[model samples]
Target: MSALAYSQLPNHLQPLLAKFYRAHNSRNRIRSEAICWVARRGDIVGGLCLTPVAQGHFLTGLLVTPPERNRGIGAQLVRNAVASSAGPVWLFCKPELVEFYSRLGFSVANCLPATLADRLTRYRSSKTLIALQNDQRMMPMPNATLNIAIACLLDDCGRILVVRKRGTRFFMLPGGKAELGETPLQTLRRELREELDLQLEDDDLDPLGHFQAQAANEPDHQVEADVFIARLPRAVTVQAELEEMAWLEAAPCERDDIAPLLRGHVMPALLARMAQAERVACCAATSDQGEIGSLAGKVSSIASSS
Candidate 1:
């Protein structure tokens, strides 16, 4: 990725980038004052721009050309831009993209400068946006550490479905360790069917990346889990080794019954995603609107659930 002030960018490249931003209906949000970080891989792949904010810098104009997505171009651009800053870097993106940004070590913004928070409030009305700040923690764990596959099922009401095995004390995500010759995804599919009585196809799940934490049930060992996200389509009944199943609140809570991986990494990430949604919903709740009231109610119901 090449980082240069918009003014210092070569003359010919200026129009090209302007064309790019305009294509996304966001023009000179890359003005001469902003620093544009462009990345090319055998072709002009994509670019992201950063500008100064009082607390730190805010990232904007992250445009990855349509044809080049899933190739990690946008991720690379984001990584480079974030590393360039010595202070907190913030950005707002659609809710669906939370996992992608979370893998890059960004969680929801805990606090924000008045200007960006107001901008986000305005953006939240028309677009379901979530504000995130770089936590800068995207280091990969060894895959050989533990061959485990896990699934996170988030319901429409925004709660995560968790299960407690027949003899287990902790409530954890529904999944299990991999068997020999099975890939993590395959392990996940089989485990889900066995424990939750829920059968899912490969397309039903989206990879959230891998995580490592001390095993909750297995002592003296750690688990390297390949985490995936899926929508909870229907009600699940406990089966096979599962003794009970329940919905876990997405909001942060001080519960001691959570498994290690769920407590350490996954919960924190989910909480970050919830942070923006809470503000969006609660902001509307404090005012008076039924639509927003529904969301606020959901949040309230979740926090109060047994």
Candidate 2:
């Protein structure tokens, strides 16, 4: 796409494209040649850039605004890049980002002998590494089983143990569906073990509550979250399998930080329960006042102690 057509997008989107340009556009050479635009409502939400060094060789860069991510935009952008380019493309990413790039038909060719040039370039500027020789490897997505998962809430020292949601940016309780060889408790424990490397005892779990929470950022998927209260034997470090994990104060409904389901529905329900508790306390106080007046006359003569 040329400048005029690319400029048609909204101002916010234009900056995203500009950022890609600034990264790919540098002092030495013209590294990027192609750009793919992902738009909605006539506004550019995402874009991908490609720089070809030779025949059947190219490097790629993808940029997407936070709000428009996880809708397969990255994959779509990569598909466009592959189709437009001639042959074996390459991309460089951190070990953690391997999965993300893998989903877009990329594989690790070499992890050893960390390139000295690449390292120095990365140290000087991140874009230098991102612009390294085009990766020729392609990784196809393997068939993966789809299943429902749930999180059981357990509080420890004011910190909450949460299972990072797979394939999304959120954390909740740690639980999932039972596989063929697993029982309910086994499945729950297994998920925790796999996701957080933790073992659980039967006595440690107490049923706190259960509710239906729609999958965050997903429309059709719904989860029957069976929340529980428990204490961890000791603090355990979270493995990288889940996106991330953290404990948040159980408070007002909000999606700014936590999962959408928790922010949109679960927190609201909990807030209502807290309000109910306050109402119950007020009623108990009123009843105690009446009882005090009735007991006052009897107390005056019933028990006179020196």
Candidate 3:
């Protein structure tokens, strides 16, 4: 596949691009200054348009033919647009597609540029536009920080419960930011109740360790975590504040969305504790067997002597 500049595209491919944009119901007119990137696999397989908006560029009309979907053509098109653009890139997509864009390194913004915001509002009202099915907005890309408490709730099967917040792709521990006057443990308990609907007392939680890592949602910001190990019940009804939940093994996970602190610090600590507990249990069992053997020999000798 190759990325072609708009002027580089053959005249024969121009019609195909127009058809692709129409199919997606894109209203953004291709202006003289706008940058369009087309992905071709002998024919036009996918494409994206970046139009200048305020201080950044708005990514629009991104589409991959159904036959070419999941083949990485869409991702390549996005990469091309981002690589060619000199400013921050922004886009409005359905709430469901937030994770998709997030994996491509686009952070969701709590605020948006005025022009893009107006366009998004209008796009939502248009029934012809399928991509803007939800009212979720995208913001200009910037770095920010998040303060939160995290928990490593391990089940009997040695799986840790990880949670992904709404509108986010990465899955971290089931905890939130520390509220004023609330200790880390208190934050953990409150978050558990609010996020997982699981209640716990101080006795149920054990301090694993304090950790720090990059925040998943905010770029260039760090997350300071007070990590703890909580014993989860056999079954849990996760609250709706989370997008999804998973019971992942305490090992090197291949998932990209796993939080940095959980992957680097929390999991390893939990694994070490589990190993230590196993060793202690094995030693205790061996000692008990040795005691039993010694008592058996003494009883046998006493019987023989009598």
- In terms of lDDT, which candidate is strongest? 1
lDDT of 2: 0.54
Answer with 1 or 2, whichever has the higher TM-score.
1
The residue ranges of model 1 lying beyond 4 angstroms of the native Cα positions read 1-145, 274-306
For model 3, where is the 10-residue window of minimal lDDT?
Answer: 128-137
Candidate 3 lDDT for residue 281? 100
TM-score leaderboard ranking:
3, 1, 2
Distance from true location, Cα of 291 in model 1, Å:
22
lDDT tens digits by residue: candidate 1, 177-292: 89997877789999998887788998999766556677777666667677788898998888898898888877665688888888777777667656866898998777767778
lDDT by residue (137-173, candidate 3, tens digit) is: 3334434545577778888887888888888888888
Q: Model 1 scores what on Cα lDDT?
A: 0.76
TM-score of model number 2: 0.38
For residues 239-287, write the lDDT of model 2, one tens digit per residue: 7467667776656645465665566655665556558868999999999
Worst 10 residues of 2 by lDDT: 1-10
The TM-scores of all predictions, comma-separated, are 0.45, 0.38, 0.52
